[model samples]
Target: MIIVIDALNRHRFKGLLDEMHRLRARVFCDRLGWDVMVRNGREVDEFDALDPAHVVCLDADGDVVGCMRLLQTTGPHMLADVFHGLLDGEPPLRSSRIWEATRFCVDTKKLNGGKTRNSISYVTSEVMIAAFEYAREAGVLDAVAVIDPVMNRVMCRSANAPYDYLGTPKPMGKVTAMAALMDCSEERIQAIRDFADIRHDVFLTEDEAEALFRSNREAPAQRTAPPAPFPESKTEKADQMPKLPRAPHSNALQQYCYEQVLNAKSQSDVDAAQALIEALSDALGTTSAAELARLARVEAQATRKSVLVAAK
Candidate 1:
């Protein structure tokens, strides 16, 4: 199952997020030998603080097997800050319609690469489907990623090649990296789905994912795995990352709206939460508390009328 953890719902998946970082540490720091920050066997960095969405893949046992990070190109990202040279001095792509996909990794030690349910190839494609579908749902048109040559080839082999490259590939310390741009169109998604032979929806609703993860209270420690030829950031420096803006949603009211969405027991209540969530997401990543309360009042009144009509 695929669970998309974002800033709004991250509070509930702390353990899963921690496991994802440790998995990154194993893949990037241990296997690939990429320069990154590893504290307590967990690889984390400045980009993690920017409220980026995480597309996580889980097995039947609820163990996180594969994962990838998604960040809006409108803000700071790996390509814009760290891999700027790959753009040949040209301005990095920054638009709401575009997002950056990075930190792609899988559990090689646990996920045996093959045609099984726990296979690395299947899980990798699953993560890609979730990321692309999540991006497409959010109105994103393109996704740019900083990847190594090996991953570039992997993309091609999976029937998901990049449509274009921003600049020439430059040799990093151990591997050459390039900025690859891929479209989030239906054709691209379908090609990958066909390659993986997956026909069902890979995504799981928040409630379902939560139940799965919580099902195994005595489950073993997260089974960490290798990214299987993916790329991650090199030489993480927190000082270079710009402080995130405080505008938009990140306030008490937004939190309240999210709580309502999660706790809604009726369809009208669900509709109200959906309106608040969408409006907040639509207006510049988030909105102010005043605006949120106003929207809540309007939605609540509509919901009350619907509830009364249903009772009659």
Candidate 2:
């Protein structure tokens, strides 16, 4: 499964982000030897502080198996600031619709199978799809990536070839970097999906992902006694009961949907937004909060009554 984490929601996925950073440390610093900074076994840099959206893919065990970072071109991104050498003395291409993708990696040790669904190849396609689709939905037009030669070839072989290149390859120590541009188009997404034969949706709703993470939290391999400082008390048995997860997206999504429906200026707009909320109700299979639903009905009825009085 794939989850897009950015500044708005990164706090909710700290553990997942930690695992992703550690995976980056292993891939970029240890294996590929990219001369990245690894502090406390996590490969993070100044770019990470910029609140880029991290497209992270998780294995079946909920461990981060793949990840890539997306940063807007208007800001201080790697290509413009750190990788200007690849721009060939040209001003860094900066546009609101363009985003820079960097630090793409997958856990090869765990996803060792060849081109199968659970393999590295398939996961790579999924990550690319997530990044492009997510960015496109957010109004991104093209993505520039500072990638090694190996990734460039992999993209070509996997039907994700870049449509253009910015400059000649520049050797950055052991790794030679080249800037490649890929469009965030439906055709591009579909072609990658075709190459990987992946038909299912790659994204998980926040609630669904939270439930999965709750279930996937690892348990102790062997039963162990409580630590000496924290001795078990008589009521500890009750406290140890597995906690139930709160319903996902019911409160927040329902309120937002109802707001969209009720606050619409025209009846047609109201109907359209109401239809969306109904569809969400079916998809999530969760009812809105009782009080909020009651309040929405009351307000809706009042709006209709006012409209009738005005017409009469």
Candidate 3:
């Protein structure tokens, strides 16, 4: 069993501080060659101790495997202070639901099944579930992550997540791109499992889960990239291509989706947006897409009726 724990919030998650730090040191510093603030055989930092939205993922053996964290834009975040110049303008994070997905580390040996007994890459499902569960609880509607395109596909296939691209692949010593959104549903998750070709009967059928959620069949992912997060002052950044963010928790990801849906000018536009939201809601939670569609249609009707009444 994989466990995802939110360990950053000092007020809420103070108890797991030590354990989480050990896990990070084990994975980030010891496994991956990233320099971390480790002291006395422990990974500890002012940022790690202070950032209240850090999340950790543990494997079946109760060992830390994959981990990702959020740096909130509503406050002073790392993206703005550290890597803002790497982006186009004011970072694409302003006026948008943005948070950084930093400290993303995975036990590559675990996923690839190397000499190490404790590995994370092999059991991606548990790691993804823990990550999403924690993100939802942390109230992170969207995330800005520096992900490799190849690893992005693997992560998407692993988690069945639908994500949107933020900008061109910034080759900052590696093929990295800034991306956003990390909400995925059980159905898409199952799809990811299927893509991975895991034959374990332990996994539930995404189709069955979708039927229960009243979501539709798996639609082909929208391949096109979205508009740049900032104005294109630089030509090279403007021309580069990237994949869209996974549409996980789209409806459940209400902070971003609701505003986009509500702003649609035409009923057709509203219908399309509502349908997308329903699919996402179906996958992420127990709620059915039809239920969401019904609610949206009902709300639309009510709004229309009010408009007529106000016209009188």
The TM-score, computed over Cα atoms with residue i paired to residue i, of candidate 3 is 0.47
Clashes of 1: 7
- Is candidate 2 or 3 superior in lDDT? 2
Best-performing candidate as measured by TM-score: 2
- TM-score, per-candidate, Cα-based: 0.71, 0.71, 0.47
Which lDDT values do the candidates have, in the order given? 0.77, 0.76, 0.48
Q: Over the stretch 1-312, how does candidate 3's per-residue lDDT look in tens digits?
A: 332333422443333345557667876678654556788667765555444455444432223455566656666555566556446664546522455666666656545653222434445554455455445454556556666666677666465544666545565443354554554344554564555444332222232222222221121121132312212223342233221233343332332333334444455656766755554452333443444455456546655766688789
Worst 10 residues of 3 by lDDT: 214-223
lDDT of 3 at 12: 38
lDDT (10s digit) by residue, model 1, range 98-182: 9999999999998996666678888989999899999999999999999999999999999899999999999977999999999
Scored against the true structure, residue 158 in model 3 reaches a CA lDDT of 61
Question: For model 1, where is the 10-residue window of minimal lDDT?
Answer: 226-235
Q: List the residue pairs that clash in candidate 1.
A: 106-227, 107-225, 108-225, 108-226, 248-286, 249-286, 249-287
Model 2 lDDT per residue over 1-312, tens place: 789999988888988889899999999988988878999999999999998999998754456899999999998999899989998999999998999999999999989778886799999999999999999999999999998888999999999999999978999899898999999999999999999987878887665455344434632221142311211232443244222233333333333444453455555555555444443442324444333334345545656766898999
Q: Return whichever of 1 and 3 wins on TM-score.
A: 1
Q: Which candidate number has the best lDDT?
A: 1
